[model samples]
Target chain A: MKAVQLKDIRKSYGQNPEVLKGINAAIEPGEFFVLVGPSGCGKSTMLRIIAGLEEVSEGELIIGSETANRLRPNERDLSMVFQNYALFPHLTVEQNIMFGLHVKKIAKSEQIKRCKEAAEMLGISDYLMRKPKELSGGQRQRVALARAIVTHAPICLMDEPLSNLDAKLRARMRSEIRQIQRKLGITMIYVTHDQTEAMTMADRMMILNHGEVQQVGKPLDIYNNPQNTFVASFIGSPPMNLTAAHVNKGKLQIANKWNIKVDGYQDGEVIIGVRPEAILPANEGLPAADVKVANVEVLGTETLVSFELEGNKQWIAKWPGQWSAEIGEILQVSVDHNKIELFDAVTGERLEKTHSKKVLEVVL
Target chain B: MSLPQAQQETQSFVKQRWLGNSRRFASLLEGLLYLLPSILLFTVFLFYPLMKTLYLSFFYSDAQGVPLSFAGFDHFVQLFSSSSFMTSMKATLLFVLYTVPPGIILALALALLANEKLRGIGFFRTIFSSTMGMSVAASSVIWMFMYNPAIGIANRFLTWAGLSEIQWLLDPGWALISVSIATIWMNTGFTFMILLGGLQNIDSQLYESAKIAGVSRFYSLRKITLPMLSPTLFFVITVSMINAFQTFGQIDILTKGGPMETTNVIVYAIYKDAFINYNVGSASAQAVLLFFGILIVTLIQFKLGERKVHYQ
Candidate 1:
C-alpha cells in the first residue's frame, strides 16, 4: 500500500463556487484519516473523488504514486462503502461480499475462502445466503464493509457508512471499523459529520466548512487548540463560548466590567473563546462574571448550564457532577485564564503568544 | 345467587344481544351501500355475461340470441374435433408466438433506449409510447394501408431495395404473420410504458455499485437489471398473452380470416360462429375455451415469475 496525495484539488460544478477549494493533503500509508464537516460541506464529494467516482475539476490525484485523474473507479483499486450501504438487494450476503472477486475473475474456491474470511471479520457469517433485505440496518452496513474489504484494496473510502444505524450501533461500528482498519493495515479515508466519530476514529482529521479547509490535525490537538472560531465552535459538543470584548488600558473590558488584567500593548476589540468545561464557580475574590442561567440539562454525571453573558449572548458551562443551579439564577463564574483562546475580531485568526506583548504585571 | 341480581344479569345480556344485532345490521347495510355500484356493474357487464356464455355453451342455441334445445357436449366435442377449429387454434398459438415474447423484447429495448439522461430524451420516450393513445381500430386501419402490397410504403421500400414485393395481408402463409406484426406494433407502446416504469423503479445505486466492482455493462444488465425487472416483465407477459389470444379487430380488418382461413384466430372463429354461421352454442364454447387458455398461460407465467420478482 502506498500513500495518497492530493495537490491543490479544486472541484466546482458549472459556474458555482468550488465545493473543495484547492485542498492539498498527503495521507501516509496505512493512516486512518477523516474528512469531517457539516451537511453539504462536500466531505462525501471528497471521498468520491478519491474513489475515482468523480473527476477533479483541477488538481493532481496521486494514488499509489500514479496520477489517478484518468483512471476508472475500478481501475483505481479503491473500495468505497457508501452512506446508504448500497448493497445489491437481490444478491445474497455471500454473493454481495464476493462481488469484487467475481469481477476480477478470481478462482471460485479462493473467492469463497476470501468471502468467508471477510464475513467472519464482520460477524455476518450466518447470513451468507440471505438477501440484503432480510438483514437489519447494522447487518447491511457490515455487508457493505465486507464487500469493500474482500476486495483487499489498499485504500478504503467510507462515506458515513454508519449514519443509518441507531446511536448505539453507530458507536459500536465506529470502533469496530477502526479496529479492522488497523488490523488490515489499510489506508482509510472516512467522511462523517459526527464529531464524536471524527474524534474517536480519526488519527488525523481535516475539518471543512463552506468548501474550505478549517483545520487539520490530531483530534485532541484540534480540540484543545482550535485554529480559529469556526474550529473552536465546531469541534466540541456544547462548543466553546465566544463573546466579543475590548482590551483597554491593559485590562480586559467585558460588558462594562474591567476586572481581569494581563499586560498587553493593544487597545483593540477581540473575540475570546473558552470551552464549556473550562468555566468554573468563582473563587473567593477572583475576577468573575454574573450570569443568569437560561437552561440546565443534567446528563449522567455532568450538568450543562447555559447562561447569557453581559452582552446577552448565550454561553454554556459544563459542570461536573450535580450542581444546584436554578433557572434565572445569577451566578458568578470564573474563567480558566490559561485555557482561553483569542482571535482577531475582524480576521478571526488566532493570535500567537510570540506576537503578543510580554506580561509585566497583573494589575489586580 | 340473589334473585334480583340474577334477573338483572339475564336482562342485561338480552339487551346487549339486541344492541349488537342492531349494530351488525347497520354496518352490513353501510358496507352494501358502498359496494352497490361495483356489484351492479360487475353483474351487468362482467359476471352475468360470463355465466351466460358458459351456460350457452352446453345448450343448442339459434341465431338472434335464443336457446333452441339441449346440446350435450356436442358443440365442445365438435370444437375439439373440427379441422377448422384446429386451424384457428393453430393460428392463435402462432400469433402468440409471433407477438407476445417479441413484443415484450422490442418494448423493453425501446424503454431502455428512452431511459437515458441525455437531453431531450423525453421526446423519444413520448414518440415510442404515443401508440398507447391509439385505439385498435385506428391502428388497424393505419397498418392496413402500410400492408398494401402494390402502393404501400412497405412495398415501395421492398422494390427500392431491388427485391420483389411479397404479399403482406393476402397470401395464406404471410397473412397471419402480417396481421400479427401489426397487432404487436399497436400493443408495444403499453408494454414499453410498463417496462419503463419498472426500469425507473430499480435503484440506480445498483448500477453504480456494479461499475465500482468492475462488472461489464452487459453482465450488470443481465444480473441486476433483468432480475429486478422480472415482476413488471411478468405483468407485461400476462397481458400480452391474453391480448394475443383475444386478437380480433386487426385480423378482421386486415385479414378477414381469408386465404383459406390461414389467419382464422379463435376469436374470429367465435365471431363467425355467432354472427356469420348463427351457431351460438359453438361460439360460446370457443369463447369459453379461449378463456381457459388465457388463464392457463397467465398462471404458467406467474408460476415462473414468482421465484424471480424481488419486490424490494
Candidate 2:
C-alpha cells in the first residue's frame, strides 16, 4: 500500500477558468478515501490526476515518497476502474482480467492462477469465456473489479464505478467492493456524486463544491460538525435546514416571529442550520414555534414534514412515526438549542459555540 | 332457434378465418410491390444474361452469338485442355495473390497512421482518400504514362539511381506486377476510408485502460486494435479478393492482355474471346467457370475467416 499526497493541485484547460483550484490532501496508506460532490465539482478530475491520465497544471504529487507528477499513466503502478466499466469488448472475461498480467509479461501459470483467483473472489468464475456484452451490467462491474484486483497495484482509483448499475445491484456491489478493498488492503481513492455511498463506505471523506474542499474528516465527524453552510446542507439526507436570522445581545430573532435567549455571542445577522431529524413535535421542555405545514410525505415508518420559514425558505423535519399532517394546517415544532448550528450570514462560516448553558426561552 | 344460432356462429368463424388469410396475402403482395423495381432490373440485366450465358456455354455459337449446334460440353472440354486458357487461369490467380494482400495491408497501414490524434491530419486523410474520387479509366490512363519507358517517372527514378531502366508494361514478366501495383493504389482509397472509419468507431476508453495496464503501443495494436477491427478487415479482404478476380478496366487500359499474355486475367480473356475473336461459346464457358470460382472462394473465406471475427 502507498500513501498519496497532493499539495496545492490545480488544473485548467487552455485559458479557461480552473477546474480544480488548489487542492491539498494526504491520503494514508490502505485508507478508503472517498471524494464526494455534486456534478462538475472536480472530484473525478482529482482522481484522474492521481491516476496520471491527466496532468496537474500546478501541484506536487507524491506517491509512496516519490514525486509522480512527471510519470506516465502506465508508470504510475496503479490500477483504475472507470465509470463505464471500460472492458475490452473483443476480449473474453478471462482475457480482460489478465490484460494487465499479460502486459507485465508475468509467467503463464502465474497469470492463470491470479486470474482464476480474482474471478472466483468476484464470484464470476463461470463467466470466464463470456464476452463483456454477454454479461449483465452488474456482472460487467465485477469483471472490471477483478481486472483491477489481479494487478495487485498498491493503489486503486475508481471513478464512480457503481453508477452504471441498478439501485439494488449498486447496493450489493457497494459492500462487495468495500470488502474487496479491505481484504486486499489497497489504498482506494473513490469518486462519487452519491452522498449515501460516501457516508457509508468512506473511512475518511472529503466534501467538495465548485473546485474547493469544504471539509474532510470521518463521515460522522463531518456530518455532525460541518464546517460551513455548504457542508451542512450537502452531507445529510433532505439536508440541514438553513434560514436567515438575527442575533442581538444574547437574543436570537427568527423570521421576526420567535425570539430565543442565546447568551455569550455578539449581536449580528446569522444563518441557523438544523438537521431534519432534530426538529420534533412541540413539547413543554423545548423552545417551540407555531408554523403552518407546506408539505407532508408519509414514508410508512417515518414521515417528512416541511414548513416555510421567513422569505419562503422551506425547512423539513423528519419525524419518527407516520404523520398525517395536512398541508396548510397549523402545527407546532420545537428545536433543541444545542442542536442548532449558526453560521455567519455573509461568509457562511460556522460560528464558535457559546460557553453559557442556559436553557433558551422562546417568546412567540 | 338452436340450429340457426349454431349456423350463424359457424358463418362468423369462417368469415374471420377468411379475413386473416386475406390480410396475410395482402401483406405478401405489398412486400412484392416494394421489391418490384430491383427485381425487374436484376432479371433484365443480371438473371437473363446469366441464363443465356449458361445456355451458350453448351453449344457452338455463330459470330452474332446465335447458337449454331449442340456441342455437348465441347467448349468446357476444349477449355480444360487449351494451354492459353490455362495461362489465363494462372495469370488470374497470380494477379489475385499479388493485389489482395498487398492492397489490404497497405490500406490498413495507412489507416493506422491516419488514426493518430495529430494536428493537420485532415490534410493527409484527404490526400490519402483522393484516389477514390478518380474513375478507373482516368487513373489507368495516368498509370499508363507513368509506366512509359522514356517519359515515365518510374524509369526516371531508376535511371537517376544509376540502375538500368527496365520496361514496366512492355516486359512479359513485369506486366502482371505493374497492373497489380496500379490496382492496389486505385483500390486503397476506399479500403483506407472504411478501415479508418472502423478504427474511429472503437471506444477510446479501451485504449486508455490498456495504457493504464502498461501495454506497449505495438502490443495493444496486435491484441486490442486488430481483434476489434477483425470484422472490418474480414469485409475488406473478401471485397478486395472478389475485385481482384474480376479486374478488367485497368487491364483493358494498360496491358490489353499483351506482352505474351502475362496479364491475361479471366475477365479480360473472356472479353477478348467474345468481342475480338467472336468465340462466344468459349467466352460463355469461361464466364460460367469464373462465377463458380468466385462463389467457392467466397464461401471458403466465410467458413475460415468468420470464426476469428469479433463482431461487437
Candidate 3:
C-alpha cells in the first residue's frame, strides 16, 4: 500500500482558467479515499492528474515516499479502472485479467494463479472465457476489477466505476468494491460525482465545489460539522435546507417570524441550514409556527412535507412514518434549536458555534 | 330469408379474400419496382457478361468473337497444360504475394505514425493519402517513366549507389517485381486512410489503462493495437490481394507482357489473347478461371480470416 499526497495541485488548459485551483490532500495508505464533486468540478481531472494521465500544472505529487511528478503512468506502479471498463473487447475475461501480468513478464503459472484468484474474488470465474461484449454491465465491471487487482499494484485508481450500473447493481458493487479494497489492502483513490458513494464507501472523503475543496474529513464528522454551506447542502440525501435569515445581537431571525438565541454570531445577514430530518412536528419540538403546506409526499414509511417560507424558499421536512396534510392546509412545525447551523449569507462559510445557549421564541 | 342472408355473407367473404391476395401481390410489385434500376444495370453489366463468359468458355469462336462450335472443356484442358498459362498463373500469385503483405504492413506503419495526436498531423495525413486521389492510369504512366532503363531516376539512384543499372521493366527477372513496387506505392494511400480510421475508432482509454499497467510501447502495440486493428488489416489485405491479382494498367503501360512474358499476369494475358491475338475462346476461358480463382480465394479468406477478426 502507498500513501499519496497532493500539495497545492493546480491544473488549467492553455489560456483558460484553472480547473483545479490549489487542492491539497494526503490520502493515507490502505484507505478508501474518494474525491466527490459535481460534474465539471475537476474531480475526474484530479484523478487523472494523480494517475499521470493528465499533466499537473503545478503541484507536488508524492507517492509512497518519492516525488512522482516526473514519472510516467506505467512507471507509477499503479493500476487504473476506467469508467467504461476499458477491457480489450477482443480478449476474453481471462486474457484481460492476465494482460498486466503478461506485460510485466510474470511467470505463466503465477499469472494464471493471480488471474484465477482475482476472478474468484470478483465472482467472475465463470466468465473467464467470455469477451466483455458478451458480459452484462455488472459482470463487465467485475472483470475490470479483476483486471486491476490481478496486477497486485500498490495503488488503484477508479474513475466512477459504478456510474453505469443500475441502482440495485450500483449499491451491490459499492459494498463489493469496499470489501475488495479492504481485502487487497491497496490505496484506492476513487472519483465519483455521487455524494452517497463518497459518504458510504470512503474511509475519508473530500467534498469539492467549483474546483476548490469545501471540506475534507471522516464522513460522519463532515456531516455533523460541515465547513461551509456547499458541503452542508451537498452531503445529505434531501440535502440541508438553507434559507435566508439575519442575526442581530446573537439572536437569529427567520422571515421576521421566529427569533432563536444562537450565541456568538455577529449582527449580519446569515443563512441557516437544517437537515430535513432535523425539523420536527410542533408537538415533538419547540413550536416555531403553523405554516401552510406547499406539498406533501407520503413515502409509505416516511413523509416529506414542503413549506414555503419567506422569499419563496421551499423548506422540506422529512418526517418519520406516513403523515398526510392537504396542500395549503396549516401545519404546525418546529425547529430543533441545537440542529440549526449558521453561515454567512455572502460567503457561505459556516459560523463557528461558541457556546450552547439557544432560546426560541415566535415574534408573531 | 336465412338462406339468402347466408349466401350474401359468403359472397362478401370471398370478395375480402380476393382483395387481401391482390393487396399482397400489389406490395410485391411495388418492391420489384423499387429494385428495377439496380437489377437492370446488374443484368446488363455484371450478370450478363458473367453468363456470357461462362458460356463462351465452352465453345470455339471466330475472329468476330462469334461462337462457331462446342469445344467441350477443351480450352480449360489446354490452359491447364499450357506452360505460358502456367507462367501467367505463377506471375499473378507472385504478384499478390509481393504486393499484399508488404503494402498492408507499410500502410499500417504509416497509419500508426499518423494516428499520433501531434501538431500539423493533418498535413502529414493529406500527404500520405494523396496517392489515392491520383488515377491509376496517371500513376502508372509516372511509374513507366521512372522505370526507364537509360534515363529513369531508378537507374540513376542505382548508379549513384555504385550498383550496376540493369533494365527494370525490360528485364524478365525484374519486371514483375518492378511492377509490384509501383502497385504497392499506388495502393498504400487507400490502405493507410482506412487503417487510420480504424485506429481512430479505438477508445483511447484502453491505452491509458495499459500505460498504468506499466506496459511498454511495443507490448501495447502487440496486445492492444494489433488486435484492435485486425478488422481493418484483414479488409486491406483482402482488397490488396484482389487488386494485385487483377493488376493490368502498369503492365500494359510499362512491360506490355514483353521480355519473354515474365510480367504477363493472368488479366493482361487474357486481354492480349482476346483483343491483341483475337483468341476469344481462350481469353474467355482464362477470364472465367480468373473469376473463379478470385472467388475461391475470397471465400477461403472469409472462412479462415473472419474467425480471428475482432469486431467491437
Candidate 4:
C-alpha cells in the first residue's frame, strides 16, 4: 500500500549549499500527507523531486513500485498543482482538463466523460468554455485541480495551491481539498508554509525545518506532545513558550515557579515548553509562578492573554471569550505537571520520558 | 471697519484668480515651447512640399518647361496605359507576395530559437537584431556580390555542392525572387526581436500547465504560443510590408531595373519617373497609390489580428 516512497533523497544545487538533505518517507495509499515548512526549507523542492520535475541528487523516488529517479515529469504518471495554479491561459476549461488525456491520445468519448465528471465534482460544469483569465481566483484553482484529477493519476502533488487565496477562501478551500482527496482516495502530498493549513488538512503532516524533518504525526499529537522545543514552537498559533529552567532532584524550577515535579531529569538546566492553553490561573495543588500579563488578543469565543515570567520569557494563556485582563496586571500562572516538556537547551533534545510507541519526538 | 475687511478679502480673491490664470498661461506657453521646433520644421519641409505636390499632380508640364494645361487625372490615366508602370505594379505585388511569408517564417524561427533557456542568449539575440543596423543599400550591395554570376560565394557553394550553376540575380525569372530573398534575410531579425520580446512577455506558467496536461510542445507552440504571439506577428508583418513597398534601395543598388525590368518594383519605378524622367506629378500619383496599398494591407492585418490576440 505504499503509494510513494522517497528513500534517503538528498538534493543540493551545485555546491552552494544542501537544500534537501537525506529525506526518507513512505506515503500510504489514499493518505493525505502534508509537508509543512518555512521558506527555504526545500519542501517544494522535495515535492518537485517526487514529480520528477527535478532530478534526485541521490537516493531513490519510488512511485507505485517504480523507481522514477531518472524519469521525466511527463512520464512519472503524477499530476502537480502549483502555488500559482498554472492553468493554461489559452485553453478553455474543458480543454485544460482534457489536455493530458488528449496528449495520451485517450478516446474522445472517455476524455469528455472524465472532464465532465471532474468539472461536476468541482462545481465548475457550466464554465467549460471559459478561458482561465475569465474565471475568478478560486475558479481558476478548481480548474487546476480538475486538470490534475482528470488525469486519474494515483498521486497528486500540491505545492501551496491555496496560498494565493484570501484568508477566508483559504480556510474554505482547505476543507474542500481534504474532501476531494478523501472522495477520490488518491495519495496526495501537499506542501505549505502555513502551519494552520498543515494542522487542519493533513491526515498526517510532516513538519520540516532547515531541510530536515522535524516531526510527522497526526495534528493533535504534534500539538500536545512535541518531541522537542522546535516543534512545540512551530506547530501552534503564536508558538509555545520555552523558559530556561532546571530540573533539580526531580523538581522543575522555572525562575520563581517552584515545587514542580518532573519525572526523570535530575540536576541539569533544561528548556521548559508549555503551550498557551496549557497554562492556567493557578489553583490548588499546583506551583505558583509570577506572571505579568503583557497583551491580550480577543477572539469571539476565546481571549488569548500573553504573559511574561522571570527572565522576560513570554507564554500565552487562553481563557473564555468573555474574559478580560488589564495590561499591566500581575497574574499567577500554572500548568499540569505532565503537560510540561523539559529539554536540553543547548542540544535542543527532549529530556523527558521516551516510549517505543506513541513517542512524540518532534525535532527541527 | 467691516467694509475695509470685506475689501481686503476681495483684493486677496482677485490676486488668487490672477495667479490661476497666469499659471494656465505659463503651462500653455511651456507646451508651445516644446512643440515649436518640430512644428516649424514640419511646416518648412513636409507640409509645404505636400501642398506643392498636391498642386502639381493636377498639371501637365510639357518638355518645353511650361505648364501647358491643367490636366485632371490625365497622368493617372496615362500611367495605367504605360506598360512599364503596369509591369512595375505587378512586380511590386509579386514582391509583397514573395517577401511577407518568408520574412514572417524566418522571424518566427529565429525568435523560437532565441527564446530557448540557454547561456549567451543575449549575445545571440543581439547578433540577430544587429542586422537592423545595416542599411538596405548596404545589405543589397553585399548580396549583389553574393549573387555574382561567376565567382559569387552562393553560386560557388552550389557548384561545389555539385549543383548546376543557377543564375541568381541575372535571370529574369529569378530576379525579383532573388531581391526578396535578400530583403527577407536582412529584415527578419527586426521582426525576430519584436516577436522574441512578445514571447518573453507570455507567462511561462501557461506553458508549464500545458505540458502537465500532456500537451506536446508542438501543440502548445501552435495553440498557445502562436495565438499569444499574434500581436507581435501582426506588428512585424505591418512594418515589413511597409518596408517591402518602399523597397527601392535594394533594386537601385543591385538590379538597376535590369533582367528585362523584372526587378522594377513600385518605389524604384517612382524614382525613375520622378528623378530620371523628371515627371514629379506621375511619381506623386504612384506614391499616393503605394500609400493606399500599404494602408489597406495594414488595416487588413490589424482586422485579422484583433480576433487572434489573447489580451491576457
Candidate 5:
C-alpha cells in the first residue's frame, strides 16, 4: 500500500472562476480520507483530478513518493468506483469483475481464479452470468466494488459510490465498505456531500467550500473543535447555536435578555456558540437562561426543544427523551458555561478565550 | 335538502349520464378522429399500393398498367426460371454484400473520429455528414463523371500511381462495384450521423471506468463501445440492408443495367421490363419478389442481431 500527498492542488475552470484553491493534505497508507462539501464545492472535481480524468491546473500529486501529475490514470495503478457503478451493461458479473485482469493480458487461468474469488467474496457467485442490467442497484454496486478490489490496487478512489442506494442499504454498505477498506488496507480518497458518511467512515475528513479548505482533522476532533464559523455551522446534525452578543468584564448580554457570567477574556461585541446537547433545563445545573419555548421535536430518543431567548433569537436544547414541554412554555435553560465558544462579532472568526480587557481590540 | 344540494344532486345525475356509460363511445370517436389522418395517408400511399401490387403481380397487364387477362402463376414461374431475372438477383446480392458491411464499418469509424474533442472538430463533423444532405441523383451524376473510362480524375490517379488505367462503369467486372462505391459514398454521411448520435448517448463514465481499469482504448472500444452501440448498429444495419436492395437511382444513372448486365439489380430489371420492354406482368412479379426479399432480410437481421443489443 502507498500513501497519497496533494500539495498546493488548485483547479480552475475556463474563464469563470477558480473551483479549487491550493489544497494540501497527506493521506497516510490505509487511510480512509473523505473530501466533503455542498454542491458545486469542487469535491468531485478534486476526485476527478486524482483519478487523472480531469487535468489539474496546478499541483504536485505524489503517489507512493512519485510525482503523479504526468501519469495516466491506469499508469498510476489505482482503481476507482464511480457513483453510478458504471458497470459494463453488456458484460456478465464475472467478466465485469475480471475486466482489469483481461485488459492487463493476465493468464487465462489467473483471470478465472481472480474472477471466481471476487464473485464469491462479493456474494455474487450466483449472479456471475447475469448482466449489470439484470441486477438491482445494490448488487450492481457490489459488482463495482468487486471490480475495484480484484485489481488489488494500493490506492482506491471512490466518488460517492454509495450515494445511489436507498437509506437502509446505504447505512449497511457504509460499514461494509469500511470493513473492506480495513481488510485491504488501501488508501481510499472518497468524495461525498453527506456529512454523516464523511463523519462515520473517514479516518480524517476535509471540509471544502467555495474552493477553499475550511477544515481538515479527525472527524470527532473537527466536530468538537471547529476552526471557524463555517465548520461550526456545518459539522453537527442540528449544528451549534450561534447568536450575536456584547461581552464586557464577566457579563454577557444577548439581545438584552439572557445575561451570563462568561468571563475570561474578550470584551465588547462577540458571537456566542454552543451545541444543542450542551444546553440544559434551568434546574439541571450550569449557567441558566429564562426562555420561551418556540417548538419541540420529539425524536424517539431525544426531544429537541427550540426556544427564543429574546424576540427573534431562537436557541435549541436537546433534552433527553419523553421530557415534553408545551408551546410558549417559559422554561429556564442553562447554556453549558464550559462549552461556550466565542467569536469576533464582525469577522466570523473564533476568538481565543484569553484575549482580554484593557485590550481595545479583540483579536479576530 | 337545501336548494343548492337539491340542484347539485340533479347536476351529478346529468354528469354521470354524460360521463359514465357514454364516455367509452365518445372516447372511441375521439381516438378514431385522431387516427384518421394517419390512416388516410397509409391507405392511399402504402396499403392501397401494396394491395394493388400484389393483385397486379398475378395478371398479365397492358402497357398502361391495367390488367388484360389472368396470367396466374405463369409470370412468377417464368421470372424465376429466366436467366435474366436470376442474374438480377445475384447482382443485387453482390451489391448488398459490397455496400452493407463496409458501410457500417466506415460509418462507425467516421463517427468515432468525430466524437473526439479537438479544435474545429465540428467543422470536420459537418463535412463528414455533408452527404446526408446530398441528393441521390446529384451524387450519381458526380460519381458518373469520376468513373469515366478516360481522362477522369479516378483514372488519372491510377495512372499517376503507375497502375494501369481501368474502365470503371464501362467494364462488365467493375460496373456493379463502381455503382456500389457511389452508393456507399452517398450513404456514409447518414449512417455516420446516426452512429454519432448513438455514441453520444453512451454514458461517458464507462470510458473513464475503462481507463481506470487499465484497459487500452482499443480494448474499451471493442468490449464497451461496440456492445453499448449495438442497438444503433442494429438499426443502421437493418435500414442499410433494406436501402441496398431498393437501390435504383445510382445504378440507373451510372450503369443502366449495361456492361453485359453485371449491374442489373432487381429494381433496374423491374424498370426495364415495365417501362423499357413493356413487360408489366413480369415486372410486377419481380417487384413482389423484392418486397419479400427485403422482409426476410430485415426479419433475419432483427432475429439474429437483437440478442446482443443492449438498449441501455
Candidate 6:
C-alpha cells in the first residue's frame, strides 16, 4: 500500500522563483525513501512541505490515501524528526515522546505504555526522565525518532536526522534508524545530502538538484545508471568523470586525436561518463592514453589518483593501495567499454542505455 | 648575539608591549573622562540632596532657625501623630491599590494587541508607546482640563449623552480615582513597550513546536509564553509600583488635595509641608517613609520574581 504520494508538488517563496518544481513520488508502506541533494537544492523545503510545515504552492499530497494538502501537521498524522532534533527543551525525553499523544488526549496509562515501548525499542528506556539538554546528540536523535515512532503514524518525515552527529555516531544511528523503521514498518521519508546514507539506507531514492528531481530510482540503479550528467556526477564520492567525446560506430574520440572504442553509440558529439572505479590501468580492450599523474590520495585500502586527460578534463581513478603510481609520471589509462555511459553533449541526456547487470523496474 | 644582550632585547620588547597595551588603555580613561562630568552632576543634584534629606529627617529647626537640635524619633512621632500625614499615607496606599493591577492589565492588553501578527502593527505599537514621550506634568494638566465640570470634554460629552455629570476631580470621593485613571493612562505605554519587547523576544519556534504537538494556542501561551515572560512582567510590575509611589504630579495638578484632602498623596503632602509650609524636617521624615515603603515593596517583588523567572 502506498503510504504517501506527492504529485506535481510545487513551492515558491513570495514572488521568487520556485524552489521545488513539480516533484512527484510515491513512498510505499514501510519503504525508506531518501531524498539526496546538495545544499540549497530545496530538499529540506520539500521535506517541510511533506511534514506540512510549509504550504504547498501547488500540488496534491496524499498520505495513507487521504488527500492532505489542507491538513495541518498534527492533523495529517505524520510525525517529523527535525534535523536539529527539535526536542522540546522544556520537556523530558518521556514527555517529548508523549507530547503528541497527550495533545490528542490519550489516556494516561496508554500514553505511558506507548512511551515506554518506544523508549525500549530505541534503547533509550534508561534516559526517559532526562531532559533533551541532558542527552548526547545521538540520544537526542533517538528521542526524536522515538517521538515520531510513538505517534504510530504511518508516515515519518526525517530531515537530515543524522547530520548533527559525529562520523561514527552518524553511521551507528543510520543503521539504528533503518533497524527501527524495519521493526516498526513505518514509511519513512528521509532527507539528506549524504550519498552514502542514501546508498546504504534508502529502499529507493530521489536525487534533486536546483529544485528539480534529477532522478528517482533504486539506490544501485542510480549509482549504476544515472539518467544525466548531473545525477552521474553528483551521486558518487569522487563523482563520475564527464568528458566531451564523440561516440560514433562504437568508437570514442577525444581531443580530436585519441580514439577508443566502446560498444553501442550511433553518432554525434557525446559526453562520456564513467565512475572513478570504472577506469582502471590502460589495458587490452581499448586504446590507452598517456596521462601525467598530478596527485594521489592514499586511503587505507585504496588510493585515489587524479590525472588530467586530454583537453584538460580531470579524471580521478580509484586504484588499490598496492597499485604502483608516482606523481608526474605519464601513465596509460583505459576504460571498461561496457561500463561507459554516453550522453549528448548539448542536451545532457543519455544517448544509449549502457548495458548493466540489472534492469530498473519502474513502478508505473 | 650574546645571552645578556638577547635577554636585554627580549626585556625591552616585553616592556614595549606592556606599555603599548597600557597606552591603548587610554581609551578607557577617555571614556571615564566623558562620564565624570555627568557622574559629578548626579552626585551633587541627586545623591547629595537625598543624603541631606535623610540627614535632615533626624533634626528639628523651628521658625527662629537658631536653636537647631537633633530630634531623631520626634519627627517620625510627629509624622505618625499628624492626621494629614496619616491621610496622605492612606491615600498613597489607596492610589497603589487603584493603579497597579489596572496598569498591568491595560499594558498587557495593549502589548498583546501590538504583538499580534496583524497589519500596521508597528504603527500601532508606536502610537501606544508614544504616550511614554509625554511628561507626567503635561498629562496631569491635560487630564485636569478634561475632567473639569462645566466645560471639560468628559463632562460635556457625558451631559451631551444625557448622563449626569458626576464630579471627577471636585468630589472628594472621586478625586483619587480620577488621578489614578490619569496615571494609568500616562504610564501604561512604558509597560506596554516592555511587555511587547518580552513578547518579541520569545522564540517563535516554541509556538511552532506547540502547534506541531497539537497543543492549542491558548495552552501554548499559558505554558510557554507566560513562563518565559515572567521576568519581564516582574520588571514591569516592580518599576510600575515604584512609579505609582511617586505619582503625586497628577493629584497635585488635578485636585490640589481639595475637598477634604482625599487626593493628597505622600509626595504632595511632603511638598506642601517642605515648600509651602516650611516644615522641611517633617517633610524629610515623610520622604524617608516613602523610600522605605518603595524599598520593601520592590524587595518583596524581587523575592517573588526569583521563583517565577524562567530563563528561557
Candidate 3 lDDT, tens digit per residue, A1-364? 9999999999999899999999999999999999999999999999999999999899899999999898999778889999999999999999888886766779999999999999999898899999899999999999999989988899999999999999999999999999999998999999999999999999999988888999999999999898988999999888999988988886788876677776666788999999999888989646658788999999998999999877587899999999979999988888877788888899999988665554434343
| DockQ of predictions, in order shown | 0.60, 0.62, 0.70, 0.46, 0.66, 0.32
- The lDDT leader among the candidates is 2
Error of 2 at A226 (Å): 3.4
Q: Alpha carbon lDDT of residue B249, candidate 2? A: 100
How many Å off is the CA of A73 in candidate 4?
2.9
lDDT for each residue of candidate 5 in A113-190, tens digit (9 for 90 to 100): 887887777788899899898999999999999998888889999998988999999999999899989988999999
Off by over 4 Å in 3: A102-105, A245-263, A267-269, A289-295, A310-313, A327-330, A353-356, A359-363, B1-37, B62-64
B121-228 per-residue lDDT for model 6 (tens digits)? 889999999889999899888888899887789899888899999799888898889888999899888999999999998776556656667877777777777877
Query: Whole-model lDDT, candidate 4?
Result: 0.83
> How is the predicted docking of candidate 6 categorized under the CAPRI scheme?
acceptable
DockQ, 0 to 1 scale, candidate 4? 0.46
lDDT of 4 at A121: 93
Please provide, for model 1 over A138-237, each residue's C-alpha lDDT reduced to its tens digit, 9 standing for 90 to 100: 9999999999998888999988888899999998999899999999999999999998899999999999988788999999999998999888888999
Tens digits of per-residue lDDT, candidate 5, B116-173, equal 9888999999999999999999999999888887757899999999999889988898
lDDT tens digits by residue: candidate 6, A134-218: 8998999899888888778878888898999999999999998999888878888999999999999999999999999999999
How far is A329's C-alpha from truth in model 1 (Å)?
Answer: 2.0
Between candidates 1 and 2, name the one with more favorable TM-score: 1
Using TM-score as the yardstick, the better of models 3 and 6 is 3
Cα lDDT computed for each candidate against the true fold: 0.87, 0.92, 0.90, 0.83, 0.88, 0.84
* Residue A238 in model 4: lDDT: 72
Instruction: Looking only at chain A, give the TM-score of model 6 against the true structure.
Output: 0.92
Highest DockQ: which candidate?
3
Model 6 residue pairs with clashes: none
Stretches of candidate 6 above 4 Å error? A245-258, A262-270, A281-287, A293-295, A309-313, A322-332, A354-364, B1-50, B61-68, B113-120, B133-146, B150-163, B248-261, B267-273
Of candidate 3 chain A, the 10-residue stretch with the lowest lDDT total is A355-364
CA displacement after TM-score superposition, residue A309 of candidate 6 (Å): 4.4
Mark the regions of model 4 whose C-alpha exceeds 4 Å error after superposition. Answer: A243-263, A266-269, A282-287, A308-315, A354-364, B1-71, B118-123, B133-138
Summing lDDT over every window of 10 consecutive residues in candidate 2 chain A, give the lowest-scoring window: A355-364
- lDDT string for model 4 (A1-364, tens) is 2389889999998777788888888889999999998998989899888876678888988888889888777777778898888776767899878875867778999999999999999999999999999999999999999988998887899999998999999988999999999898989999999999999998898888888888888999988888778888889987887888876775667666455655546577889887777777776455556678899888978889988776566678776655677888888766755567777878887775744332322111
